[model samples]
Target: MKRWWIGTTAALMLIAAGCAGGTDAKSGTNRHDRHTSGQAMPAFVEQSTIPHVREAYAFAEANADQLQYIPCYCGCGSLGHESVKSCFIAGKKANGQLEYNVHGSGCEICVNVVMDAKKGIEAGKTLQEVRQQIEQKYGPQLSPTNTPAPPEGK
Candidate 1:
């Protein structure tokens, strides 16, 4: 009976730990948290077929000027531009070779937009076409470099 109790206790503890994201084993975030703790974290982004990540970044950066830079109304307090990180692949570990982590940056909305845009681009959508799609999907209030708010006196 004592052995049974000990076994049950250990199992419960292990189960609890697993439930709490304790099983990160690699990146060590709360599983709930997008950011990880270690410098040598696993890749936070997924791999892309763009040949070069720079291209992907350029693609995202190009029309960034079109979207609005509103604060995340979701109360996360993050900016809309920050959501672009979801589009490109990032290395999971800081020094762990630059592979696409897919899980690192970007929110769900941003990720969906980015991935869709990427797909569209691959399917021969012009950059403008992709940007328009993003605008239509996320609204105009999501980009950053949006004409600087037309200045106060203008």
Candidate 2:
């Protein structure tokens, strides 16, 4: 819905003033604060007919903070992907709205990773444990993006 995108756009604008290296009040992390949320997805992803594509995009959008620390084992690093989250989001637009990456729409591995992480987290698996399992399972056979490991004890 255009209304939802407008709201999401407005929300991102509020945080646009926070520059890179600035501390984000909500997370207290020392990094560039880019907008992230389950606001609204791009039309293609929102209306995707492929099985699990829409669901995965929604999951990635909603759980970006957690997904950011998980790596994509689908060889998207060549495209400058740093983590699983990168498979769905390229970056933010100058208007502060997110720029959706089209890579995930056609990549089964990307969606599967997102869903696996989602189900695992929902089933009480910690991010670290989930990352470990994903790494062991996919790392051995697939190309990994530049995803960083989950923080210790998290």
List, residue by residue over 1-154, the lDDT tens digit for candidate 2: 9999999998887767555357656656444223245244465665556678877877777788899999999898998899999998777789876778888988889998999899889899989998988888899999888788788877
Query: For residues 1-154, could you state the per-residue lDDT of candidate 1 as single tens digits?
Result: 9999999999999998888764466755446433222223333333333333433343444433322221121212233224344233332346663344343243454445555566765687665665556656666555332312322321
**Per-prediction CA RMSD (Å):** 13.8, 12.9
The lDDT values for all models are: 0.43, 0.80
Q: For candidate 2, which ten residues in a row score worst on lDDT?
A: 30-39
Candidate 2 at residue 9, lDDT?
A: 93
The residue-level lDDT of candidate 2 at 55 comes to 76
CA error at residue 137 for candidate 2, angstroms: 2.0
